[model samples]
Target chain A: MPFSVSKDEILETVHMFQMQNLDIRTITMGINIQDCRENDGKGTGKKIYEKIVRYARDLVKTGEEIEKEYGIPIINKRISLTPLSMVIDGLSCAEVIKTGKYLDKAAIEVGVNFLGGFSALVHKGFTRGDLALIEAIPETLAGTERVCSSVNLATSKAGINMDAIFMMGRIIKQTAELTGDRDGLGCAKLVVFCNAVEDNPFMAGAFHGPGEAESILNIGISGPGVVLNAVKNYPDSDLGELANIIKNTAFKITRTGELVGRVASRRLGVPFGIVDLSLAPTPAIGDSVADILESMGLERAGTHGSTAALAMLNDAVKKGGAMASSYVGGLSGAFIPVSEDAGMIKAVEDGALSIDKLEAMTCVCSVGLDMIAIPGNTAADTIAAIIADEAAIGMINRKTTAVRIIPAPGKKEGEWVEFGGLLGRAPVMKVNQYSAADFIKRKGRIPAPIHALNN
Target chain B: MEESKKLIITVLGHDRVGIIAGISNILARANVNILDISQTILQGFFTMVMVVDFSGSTVELAELKTLLGEKGRELELEISVHHEDIFKFMHRI
Candidate 1:
């Protein structure tokens, strides 16, 4: 069937751009560095550096060109690589840190904001390289400016790696202490995931999975404000009608992302991977997932009925995005990262939102316990328990979930940590004072859920 | 003759006299041919959408956009010049 553009549709889209804060969030180029591995750590680091700079040289230029021609804002151009641990087998901590610096340098040379995949996947067990990478994270993150890291410590099939989780808890605390002067800013660049997808274009969780092609471009599109505006139009609409509106709006947003992804892929000569249809928010007002939920008729985001609202919103987005694009991978739902969302920050400030309530909301949303700031005194064991809880949700539900919490150093509850830009400012919230130390100290894999036995 | 490159220009602001005239003057000076035009006033606010042929224009798209932006600023209006492809791709398939 032939498609015709209507004047009203044109105006509506233009209005979305002008007034609604609609924009393509990120165009991430995933480069596989598996082949860059060498017999020595220095050789591998040099090879990885050359490969990334060569592949991503034109990324920013192309993104700017597309943004200008399409008249749509492309907020970030980023790169994700094959997990560094895989290429740093048997490497020392210093070698791993050196490799991280190379990744950081390459990112700066290419003019991308961040470079991901300083990661290790130990869903089952950790290798020597994984252990070294984990050990090197605090120094690597503290030493480098643009490198982002993630570790997959759990999966539905492999169960939760309590050992890794326990270690990550300590690593997170040490990272906070090392970057304490900056309100534990290094933790903001790290993520812990369960069932983490390979082609996610968002950071700091994005890493090019082994199953992916050598190189591909994935797009993450966001329009929380657009969805909120659409939902507000139907003040008295029934639940079903409200869901329909969200679905239709997501369809248009996803279509725009697909168009941008295809064009960027063609221009960059890399295969188009997927469009992550996540309602990623920024610190800016009017662009928030929590506000969208509130527009669905809640007095506040973390109050009662918030989870149900979030579940419906996530489902409708997936349904709409699935129809609009041939391929939909990554975390394709509403992200409830606190610092990055204005409504969520307000909800936290109003005492309506707590870590527990955010945890409950994560059971239905795309990610878990994201961008939350905890009091500096929060224990490492408590952080581990938080990761374990979120991982269990992702594992049992057979979906991807992640935690990116920052334990602000020397900051107490009610104080704010300002990370600036897309990292945003997060008001420090309290964590449960009760100890999970004994539970976390039991370092072994939590058995896979019974339902994971699909075979 | 080369086929004319199509463009969409949208102008939105408070209702005022000579808004269209001011915009048209800039387009005429740039050698852009106005193919179709639509304008309306709602709640005392003015909105206009124009489809213009830029193939015969003396300036590039970037230069034309800058020229229109300056005119819009002088008239206290918000103006945007977009290649027609963006609308076609977004509103259609």
Candidate 2:
């Protein structure tokens, strides 16, 4: 038969748009700021600001224009740059903080919501610049509104950097204390990654890798509601059949990303990058990845079969997305950020989900320990151990994983800490009270897995 | 040239008289040519899909979308106008 969209199919898609929350999550313009470096730190910061503003001037406008034309809601216009640690090689921590201020200012000027790549990749070990940037994360994040920071501490090939992980735990705790007035909001803007991808268009982990083009455009598409609605239609279907349905739905969703990415790239005059088909959730009812899992015969999310269900969902999403787009990279899987998803928040509140369950779930999902809120009394070393656990998972599996947990200062377990907007409210879930201080203090690099010997 | 500017306009609302007349009148006044039209009333819910060539229209696509949106609000209908490329790209290879 000739290829044609039937009326029913068209109506279904319309329903997805009108009722279900199907929208483009982000259109990230990756601009290289490596050339903006100067001999003087101040001069380099100014150059970086000017370069980003120049490259991303039309980014927000272009995104808005496309949204109006295509009738698709593009939620965020963002920018990612070359990692600050690399660009500010010889700069001090003060200079790096200044650079972050410039980046925040540029993002505000360009009208983008967030700007990423205030990052350091120390999967093996930290350079001087990397250590300085990591040390300044608390002050940098507290000082800037739109700047996001990430530190990659492990990779399958390079092995886990236990030193960096330990340092990040302390940095995360300090970040929380620095922004304690807003329920440790600084921690929400920071992510700890293992096997971090270069062209990821999502925050708080997106960064421009050295291998990337000078400038490029990447798209992230969101549609957990669409998938959940599709799954609900097949109550009696087998797991294999359910996977097929999700795969088909994901194909359609990724196609929209491809279309939007091409148009955005053409309009912005930048090379088109990947369409990251991640099932990112929002704090709206029915717009939840947890709900999708719950729809597949689970009593609730965080139950026993949840891991297997999430693994299938993640794999099927990637398989379908890979087939739909020619360049499907980034962390293209289901994101289980608790605060961002209404279902997850409810699950946590109802005692159906806990920190341990979320950690287990992360083994199969895209990111780890994401948007989780714990008691303020949780020690720095415990947070470090949490990061170490997540890093180990990513290192062993050879997949990208990250931790974006918040130790809500003074908040007890079951209490709520609201970050507002897309960084939604999170209930402070209980973390293990036992100490890992000694284990964390004995830090060194964990050797690379045997799988890394493939080359 | 006109075919290249094809747009699919979908109108969804409770069944009512003059729904098509109201839409077609605006299209004719705007110098937009209707290439194909299909509509159905299912369970008292009126749904209409129209393919229109916007190359000949006087106003920009953005302006037309706003006008259609206002008309939709007045008629208590949910009207969406999307470029044909979206459907073609999604359904085809």
Candidate 3:
């Protein structure tokens, strides 16, 4: 059979060919709706809907024209906003839910896939609006399809909020119980963050950060399959060789991201921030960071030397990306979301990985406590300790991190909770039984460690 | 659903003799026009970026992608063919 054949390796090689040497991943639009406020939630909701649709109407068309002229692939066209909760004061939980619907409606009309900023920022303490919005997360997430939310509960300077962490553990459990039919998956759209960045372009937790200028475009790039396939060639390659292949692959991937972000920024009339060069593993089996390590020869993840492997993966992704693009920011390492990555799911099924090991990995990766579910009655203080520990790590390391954990109301350890359709399912892993009341009860910003400032 | 428009062909990864010749031959067979093509090799990495006009071809974009992808596999090189517009629409804000 004489035939020309294209391998995954070759297809990935020219994956970003349209760029004229430009590589594009995501094009995120930040829209401010502060002016859309009204005397009541109902009036404000209408304004919010109209304003978003009107402003974003030309986005898709413009993207098309640019793609045609420039020969680039713009993978995602998304929108972020000023947290709607910030605008809708005196609005009941029901009204906030309506506003979320409006946000979803506008996104659909404009043909954008995802929209974020259904959020709160109460690391220090809750405000009236923040509290109201926090209360509405379960309902709002269950009610809307596209509105993503985040609440920053920890920061380098402000530290973690034990009260919010405590409340959130219960809230996640309650939300799961309410949305049990939907796999209690509403939590996937929301992330409780420590040092959440303003420029991230990925979702569930990617809000337009507070420092965003009027409206700017940011890009996030992911191609775990590309990296996985690149490294796959040398099945018997050693650690250094495997690391080199990952670095080389990421350099090209990041270059693609930089090219796309700059061009989009120019077209959209907004300045571009850094490119998030995260591996961003998908639910697909072959496209996982864990699978990459397994390919490097691990029986399964979370054994003695697992952290060293992860540390190298994180460092190499950064080194390559930093060289490929000057505008690199956000969490640039491989995302290890428990439900999202195939190997992690299998590890849980095999009982090889635990919550503590996952937490330990967060010390090296971009986000914290990703896609994990716990028992409903897990004490708020215990949850607080988890958040505090993650916060302390982020504070010490000075990297952007987040936690989007769910506590399934009645589901105990080893029970599988499914958040169907791309969100995936995960067997609830074990959390520690020991209490840390004294540590969590102190409830003040753990002062930034002296070692953080060392150059 | 927008129609795919404007084609871009890129070649990258390892370099070997006849890499471009084989790929360009496929485009020629399809009656596709190469509007622009650029290739560079640095640090032992071979990179090539091209713009193709499928407006002149009988094959759909996917067919071309598949066709060239095959050639790429034979040579152990990376090759990509795209609608110049999809990537741009995705990139352009």
Candidate that beats the other on TM-score, 1 or 2, i.e. the better one: 2
Q: Tell me the whole-model lDDT of each prediction, alpha carbons only.
A: 0.90, 0.90, 0.73
Deviation from native of the Cα of residue B44 in model 1, angstroms: 2.0
Comparing only chain B with the true structure, the TM-scores of all models are 0.90, 0.92, 0.83
Q: lDDT tens digits, residues B1-93, model 3?
A: 244445656677798899879988998998987766667785797877666667778886657777887888898876665544333433332
DockQ (Cα-based) per candidate?
A: 0.40, 0.53, 0.13
Error of 2 at A26 (Å): 0.4
- Model 3 misplaced regions, further than 4 Å: A1-12, A15-25, A60-75, A89-94, A234-241, A376-381, A436-455, B1-80, B83-93
Writing each residue's lDDT as its tens digit, candidate 3 over A251-357 gives 87786677666666676667777788887765766767787777666789876667788888888888878888868876678888888888889988898788888
1 or 3, greater by TM-score: 1
- Candidate 2 deviant stretches above 4 angstroms: A1-4, B1-3
Tens-place lDDT per residue, model 1, A1-455, is 12246667767888888889999999999999999988766778889989999999999999988787667899999999999999897888888888888888899999999999999999999999999999999999999999999999999999999999999999999998999989999999999999999999999999999999999999999999899999999999999999998999999888889888888888889999999989899888999998998998899999999999999999999898888887999899899999999999999999999999999999988988899999988889999999999999999999889999899999999999999999999899989889999999989999999998989
- TM-score, per-candidate, Cα-based: 0.96, 0.98, 0.79
- Highest DockQ, which number? 2
True lDDT of residue A429, candidate 3 = 74
Give per-residue CA lDDT, model 2, range A362-415, as digits (tens). Answer: 888898889999999889899999999999889999888899999999999988
